[model samples]
Target: MYRINPPGVYAHESAMTEPRLRARVERVAAALAPPRVPVVFTDEQLPELIWEGRWTEGLKPMGTLPEVRDPVLVFSTFRFDGKEAERGAWFDQLGTGIGGHLRNALVGGGAFHWFPAGLKEDPYRKEKVCRACWRLHFQVGCLHRCAYCGYGGVLVTMVNVEEYIEHLDRLIERHPWQLTYLLEDDADVLCLEPELGCLGPIIEYFGTLKDRYLIIHTKSANVEWMLPLKHNGNTILVWSLSGPEQSRTLEPKTGTLEERVEAARLCQEAGYTVRYKFKPILPITGWREDGARAVATALTRTRPDVISLCTFMWMECAEMVRRVGRDRFDPHFLAAAEAAADTIGGLRTAPFPEDARAEMYEHYLTEIRRWNETVPVSLSTESPSMWRRFEDRLGMNAANYVCGCGPQSTPWLRQLPCSAWQGVERNDQGLRGTW
Candidate 1:
């Protein structure tokens, strides 16, 4: 009964012979425990990183995954997986950990610690750096078919979970400053969590860290497995939110708008500090009202510790749309995105148009902030010009909670700041208020 979706409820009829089902459930639950470590990754054990979509048309089906691990078997029983919403900031953040430096190193980036294998100067040896927020991910790539997502089809699985755990533990033991870590990016951790069989163990592992935050972001409502675990309030479950319309239509394969909110509520009820990411805000026709309603719904559903907001910054996501268009995604939106696409920060994106972006940001921000006045509402700033434009205007802090473009970030050093709003200054309201 501890599980929201109780164990054995979804079991096949053949296994419903009470004792057999119970035994099966017990076995599955037992597997969630952390494996005895010293995870040895031999020369043949290096993880595979494929840069392609898992599915041809929409999101890759869970069936497409090659592995038949026990966790994957547990995952197969679930519909979709954990949290909700959308974010393009991660596209930039993850790109850095994969090869690029983080905000501590790249100003505009966050303090991210990447997998040593990818970041090392030599294969076995590690690169030297001052400090990072540790972009630690046991998983990458997602199966959700959200239109705004860039990391589709190309599913990546991190096979070396025990090894990653070892590396992170060693890093934490050695470097006290590496307190924060982003647990996901390549994929929604919870989406494939059951199959991965790492979520419970990972949360328990991180719980041992004092004053540390392990942020898990997702657009799935597959949280049935999490309720039974003892989190110790160290894990922050974040949903990548979108306008309700966008959530339903654009990101259809992901959980429905309400389902995500409910999932967050479930996590909050279970003692996890839940957060929402209102990023890649698409202010299309009825976006204002839809966005407002969605924000209100989120505030009402979950006790959000913080609400991070960011408008759509296309990056390479638009090209993804061109390559593999979904039914709900509009051609006009893509056309507008293509037309609006340009270099922002170091990344090319379809930034909110100078005229419209300002008003849209002001309108939704004013509305979003109005809902939860006490919770620190953070906004995503991809570039310096972006930083300057949105900076201090909303009264929210620069965010390292997720995007790592907080007050400490300095990506501006390498990339020329965008000057779209050159003459504009934040009025008393922090917005020009002139559309």
Candidate 2:
């Protein structure tokens, strides 16, 4: 019922006072009438909308990473009401289900899968479902068409926002404190905010509960819209980020790296707790230099409450590369990325040769740990057993440390071993816990 205009769309009274500008406003307003109900836009309709446009001109040329072999065509089907809509694609297993499918179909599959597995099986709670922290594409369809993304045909259909709200209301009534109503959906809250305005309402509704935390993760730089909303400590905003190089090369349409940092800084300034996710850390030729520089830049620019660093893995992303064609970019980089994951104990178990994977993991762990000692680091979708093996080597419990929010009470405290912490402190000069 309320109309919230997007920024940079309105005119000043000086212009409005002119008959011509006034008439134009009236015509534009009439043309821009709100739909009777929010309409779901499918992937078919997305291309026509200018918001889905992408720019990828200034990216670096693909380097020599090993090419993906034996690409697997995966179909991620979300079933509701016994009806199914299918999205399928070939991947080399380096991305999430939604992202992989989108890449295979849209961007021609040169990108790697970034989605982590076992998120649906939260190891912490046997009865609880451990959905991945980032669920942007699955829930909302693909909103932003980043240039590297291959999901051009992916459609984001809008479900009835009120209906979903009611569903949550009913669920809460039936099972009090049973659900951690975390909005880990792939669609960012900012993207949905303009349409549903659900944040304030959801917060208000959930505020009545005695137990529950609403986690909203995003990479969007749209912060002004969120500042005015009312939220209690029950909500946490997890932001995914990368260094300037990665941003420039890989993340084409998302907000600039500096803008994302500014957004995180603004959220912290607004008294809202925020978490940092530096996941799928790609291994370029100078990965150590690049990754360390990224972390240092982020640390200096925005002091988030918690930071989580992850190494890159490519189990489900191989198919994407095959679909996109090797000639588009150097397949060697992808192969090398796979090699790096294999070396790092984070490779997927079953069917994969254990001896080769173990050897790769050994080398990968040694390097990543050597660089980032303080921040709590963990693997996603890695077999619990394999993680345990590396956890022993790293001197931490990987099973319990699934989500990279750091520790529960003192999340800001880097969970490195005391010796390693001291080493990091000495090297990361001038770095402090507080902003």
Candidate 3:
């Protein structure tokens, strides 16, 4: 029987939480590690999304303009008309069948991942974060658009934040185990927070559950307001940082590296666990030396609990990739990154240059160790080759970290991660993530 929530209220597929069944599904998901960094969906699907107003509506200005703001980010609210209808319908479609049950149990609130289990469990995994984290989002797109960027400029808000909490409560009720929730996957949770006004209510809700937490990753410095909220040491505050050059060229509207670092410090001082993600490391001129200095500054200044490094993979955002001219990229490294391309997980991605990335990873890792040897150092393992190389270099896959929630699942259109992959067989066996 299908249980429906009230109008404008999103529903969970299974009313009764099946821990055993969820465990079965999650075990398979955790065991099957992917070969590349994959999102819940591919950039190829962006066309259909944009046309429906589910993604972007050009770089035009909209919403209540921030009186004290830059002219570039003209728009205040996301042009996500019909998004509620689309997501509501998607939830309805997944409301039936075992597939929906599996999705509900899976990390993405319905998106299935092949390998849910990452590195072996360690007691001191992230210092402050749970090793296993469930990814949740209240919005899509972002307000930050840098030079070598793709999804940052887009900001698609997901209404029904309260309704989603109701569904999440059922997820927790089903399995009342200690777990962490990662917020702001599609957009920075704290960037437009003042307008949305969701942090307090969401934090209060999480506090009710036994051992529940919220992890937010952002580059924006608008975190001062959240410092005073009672988090119970549950929220893991993260900043996606870069050196001065990359920050200036790539991240335009976002604040300076120093500003973001200062925000991390404020959070740290306010009694919150802080972390850093030196991702999509643009290996440009003097990148190694400069990057090392930046890493040194972050480690020495903020002393975050963890530092995860990664290189760029903009293949999914073809439009953005086209917008960024070839001159902006390291041509020599680009060739190598392109050569390492392979179908890892469900998406088709060519990861960052492995050799060049290995060098950059070593530099950041070395610098991080200099100031804070206790802080865990990590490398992004979105690709199989990248994961293998990092594991080989570090002598082990960095245990304490978070991975993508897998390819985007369009439940309204195609609930499966890849509708095309369903017809095919892997190793001549049954389909993966199939009911």
Candidate 4:
């Protein structure tokens, strides 16, 4: 294992021969080979300029645009069947709304390369092979009517509990020793857990697996049902958080920040490890101070075991833009995302300039690091270089690798050097062990 120093930098000692690296690379290459999907869509198939009645007319720019150029129209696509009643409503609304813009931006500028028909082929599916630390949404639709949330009634949920559990069982069988599993398709696992009666069983099942870890994250404060469960080290509860301004404006349906923090405290007090995800970090005028204070308050209240930080990401989807609207959208947030994207070699070859994004990232990083120390920090859906810079600033290396196993492994591995191989000894005051 590698040893990670303060500020998060990684240094590896064991050198794999070219042949070994080549073989490992080959295996990953084979695993990443795109699977055949029944349905696929590209940007060219969608329309742009929704209700084209002068998009820029009378629209005052909210904030100063970062030095980065605006995004170029790239190809984008949305594929979902409207056959089932529940799913049909979701697809129709999404298609006519945010999905339209996403498709236009992606395909128009040739940004994202592929679009799958359903969530399964979306690559970020919750199964072990495809899932990332970012926690894939499980419920097809969201019930909460948060004004700022892009997903409201846009997705569907699986009504068949046993069948869904069986599907997860199959996934587990394929990767039995998997370290972590994150339920991401929806905001609150308990929101649907009460209806399906699956939370207890899922927790029990994961408990049976000695090495694996499970995390149930939510924005809901309806956690009375979770208070009674027998706690274990492998099971962690995470809560998504926003500042007071955001909670009042964008997330009126979700619990207030105080309530969420109280819930987190309750879980922690119950001996359940908890994680805090401060995502889509909004850029309201006083966001810097408000965001930091919110985080500090949460830390004092919950004393969480881990924390992850992320900014908003803009997809080429039209429905996404329409739902959020340019008015509420902060140019700084977009510029920060663009900067992160640029550092990673521009996921989309669009007009968003990389230099501007880099500056924005620097500003964001400097501001957020001021809140606290000791808690591990990471970005959601960020590029490698962005993370590299973060790690470098934190005096840490990429010792922690995220994916399906990231939630579990990151917390443990982040304690060591990023470059150290498993079983390696470090000179950090006799702290030596496999993380």
**Candidate 1 vs candidate 4: which has greater TM-score?**
1
lDDT of each: 0.48, 0.41, 0.48, 0.44
The TM-scores of all predictions, comma-separated, are 0.60, 0.55, 0.61, 0.58
Q: Estimate, for each residue in 1-435, the C-alpha lDDT of model 2 and write its tens digit.
A: 113222112222322444543443343333333312122234343233323322111111122223211111111112222111222222223223334333332221111112222343334332111222211222333333343333222233222233345544544444331223445443454643433344556655555655555556676777767665565555567777765666666554456678777887787777666776775454434545555665665667665655554443333334334432344333455564445443442333322333433444554455445554554545444455655566766555543453433212123434433321121111212211100
Which is superior by lDDT, 3 or 4? 3
On TM-score, the candidate that comes out on top is: 3
| Model 3 lDDT-worst window of ten | 1-10
lDDT of 4 by residue, 1-435 (tens): 001011111111111123432332223223222311111222222222322422222111212212111111111111112222343344445444443322222222111112221134444322111122223233432434454453432222222233335545555444433446676543355644442344666676666666667777677776766677754556777787877777766665567888888888887776667777776565655666657666766877766655665554434323334444555546675555445443533233122233443444455455445555655555554444555666766554444533212433533344433332332221222111100
**Winner by lDDT between candidate 4 and candidate 1:** 1
Runs of candidate 3 exceeding 4 Å displacement: 1-133, 152-154, 158-160, 176-178, 314-321, 338-349, 384-389, 392-435
Candidate 2: RMSD to truth: 14.0
TM-score for candidate 1, residues paired by index: 0.60
Superposition error at 367 for model 2 (Å): 11
In candidate 4 the C-alpha lDDT for residue 202 amounts to: 65
Say which prediction, candidate 1 or candidate 3, comes out ahead on TM-score.
3
Residue-wise C-alpha lDDT for candidate 3, range 1-435, written one tens digit per residue: 001111111112221134432332232223222211112222233233334432222332222112112111111111123243343346445433212222122212322112232334433322211233335655544556555533432433333345556655655444333245566555566654544455656776765655566667788888878888877776677788888877877676676788889989998998777878887677666677768867876876786765667666434323324544455665666566555554321232234544766666777877776777565455554444555566644433433233221112110111222221222221212211111
